[model samples]
Target: MKLHYSPTSPYARKALAVAKHHGLAIELVASNPSQNPAHLLAVNPLCKIPSLETDDGVALNDSPIICEYLDHLGQGPKLFPAPGPARWRALALAALTDGILDAAVPRRGQQAFPMDEGRSAMVGRFQSAMSRTVDALEGVDLSGPLDIGKLGVVVALGYLDFRYAQEPWRPGHPKLEAFYAEQMKNPIFSETAPPPA
Candidate 1:
């Protein structure tokens, strides 16, 4: 499999971590979506990082979708549970984590431009969403073997730390802080951590 990725992309890191956990042999192809590299565009019209081109020649995009595909081919316990309440919970957690990324990623990009009234309002909204999600995560059961939900949490929190270090998410979210610390020790995370900010 060939993975189009950037070292700094949390989404790419999540996909890479899943592949590594599965012990899959993947060829990493450096791609900068901002530059619209033709190879990346061929796999993902969105020009997104973390796009996977399977050995059979099928192209897949989106971190969750790619992770699920990798999980299906993995040898050990599944990251995604079989259809049941457990699956729903894991998926729900994944959604929440993605929501955090949905806000944070663009918010960070917007910082490159001059801040104005509209940008300020959008930034505030993003911060509020992230804050509420972190608060909600504190009350959830984060203890478990490695799973998609846990992976999402780890990657999401890691992204916050990498890009928003000055605005820490650790304060008042002790459970998440501890959970993240423990998860970071896992090779799946430690090895795939985004290049230092």
Candidate 2:
């Protein structure tokens, strides 16, 4: 299997971390989606990073889907829960974390342009969403084996450190901060740390 990823992409980091955790033998193909690379676009019409090409000529796009596929390929404890209340809870938490990235990535992109009232409003909205989401996550239990939800939180916080280090996210959220710090010690995360932009 081959994973098409950008070193700085948090979404790509999620998939890569899952593969690493499961000890999957996958090739990392450095790709820049911004360039509309033919290899990426051919497999994923959305031209997104973190696209996975299976050995059987199958392509999987989207970070969650790619992570799920990798989870199935391994023998470790499941990253995604089997169908049940736990599954729903895990999926919801993962979605909340991914939502933070959804807002943050575009907000970062908008920074390249001159600030306008509209752009400022959008940035403010994204900031508010991320702040509220982190606060909510502070109360959630992060115990038990690592799952998709926990991985999502790890990647989301890492992205903030990578792109929005100046923003005050860790001052009051000690639990979330601690969780992130602990996860950073994992080989999967430490080894896959994003390159400096």
Candidate number with greatest lDDT: 1
Cα lDDT of model 2 by residue, 1-197, tens digit: 99999889999999989988988888989999889999888999999988999999999999999999999888988989999988888899899999999999999999899999999999999999998998999999998788999999999988988899899689899999889889999998988888875
Q: What is the C-alpha RMSD of each candidate to the true structure, in Å?
A: 0.9, 1.1
Error of 1 at 88 (Å): 0.3
Instruction: Give a tens-digit lDDT track for model 1, residues 1-197.
Output: 99999989999998998988988899999999999999999889988988999999999999999999999999968999999998999999999999999999999989998899999999999989988998899999987777899889999999999999998999999999999999888898999998888
Clash count list over all predictions: 0, 0
The deviation in Å at residue 65 for candidate 2 is 0.4
CA error at residue 181 for candidate 2, angstroms: 1.7
Model 1 RMSD to the real structure? Answer: 0.9
Quantify all predictions' global Cα lDDT against the true fold: 0.92, 0.91
lDDT of 1: 0.92
lDDT of 2 at 149: 94
Please report the candidate that would top TM-score against the real structure: 1
**Candidate 1 vs. true structure, TM-score:** 0.97
